[model samples]
Target: DAGITQSPRHKVTETGTPVTLRCHQTENHRYMYWYRQDPGHGLRLIHYSYGVKDTDKGEVSDGYSVSRSKTEDFLLTLESATSSQTSVYFCAISRDEAYEQYFGPGTRLTVT
Candidate 1:
């Protein structure tokens, strides 16, 4: 099983501020993903990493960027946070892209 954790479980910030969220895993999974969960949008992919230094944009990667410097850590940064970006963010890990993913507890970010 994959063990994942996110830092700063909750946060509140003003618009235009820069925010970065960290995701760490213990299982050394090869695939890591960042997603945001909202009431109506469900879970939307923000970015994903296939391996160390191998990252790619997802459907909602406009305002976000991700970097994976190591196998166990993936970081997501918001260039300029906005109210519309406020939501619950989750980190997921999977051995393969087609395999089942395990999610972290999540981080609640509120941008005012």
Candidate 2:
């Protein structure tokens, strides 16, 4: 299994501000993903990266951006934070052709 961790763990910010969350992995996986968990929406994908500098939008990609400069790091950034974006964010990693994903601890973000 891959070891994954998210930074800050918790955050509180006002609307219109910029927020960036980080996800780090011990094992280098070919695929990395960012998802947000909400009360009713469940887990919705924000973005995913297959390789360094290669990324694509997911189900709920609006207001979010991602960058993968290195294999061990995947970043999720809110271009301009909004209250609607407040949710528990999770990072997941998987090997090539493997659908099983190992998720990070999760980051709780609150937008005021």
Candidate 3:
């Protein structure tokens, strides 16, 4: 209802598996971001895109990748996920920096 949704709200897998998380949005804002919130590290940026075909890596982009071919969709892929990657992932969008960000319900990933 907040203009966005995340798929596979909960996932559990082995230490070596590929995972892909999907973020779907109704508001065609110019900015979208993926962040992981761990126990104490707080929200760490993973990747973000300013517009279609325009993207950049964030602080925690290791083993992760993202794509935004359209304004309404963004995807985050973990190439060979590992146990250390276990965290709650969140997708957020902003039309302007001054306004509040709308966040999608998180995806919890657990690797054993």
lDDT of each: 0.95, 0.94, 0.91
Write the residue-wise lDDT of candidate 2 on 1-112 in tens digits.
4699999799999999999999999888889999999998889999999999999999999899999999999999998999999899999998873678889999999999
Better of 2 and 3 by lDDT: 2
Q: Model 1 over residues 11-80: C-alpha lDDT tens digits?
A: 9999999999999999988999999999988899999999999999889999999989999999999999
TM-score list, all predictions = 0.97, 0.96, 0.94
Q: What pairs collide in candidate 2?
A: none
lDDT score of residue 103 within candidate 1: 97
Error of model 2, residue 65, in angstroms = 0.5
Backbone clashes counted, model 2:
0
lDDT of 3 by residue, 63-88 (tens): 99999989988899998989899999
Cα lDDT of model 1 overall?
0.95
Q: How far out, in Å, is residue 47 in model 3?
A: 0.4
Quick one: ranking by lDDT, best first?
1, 2, 3
Pairs that collide in candidate 1 are none
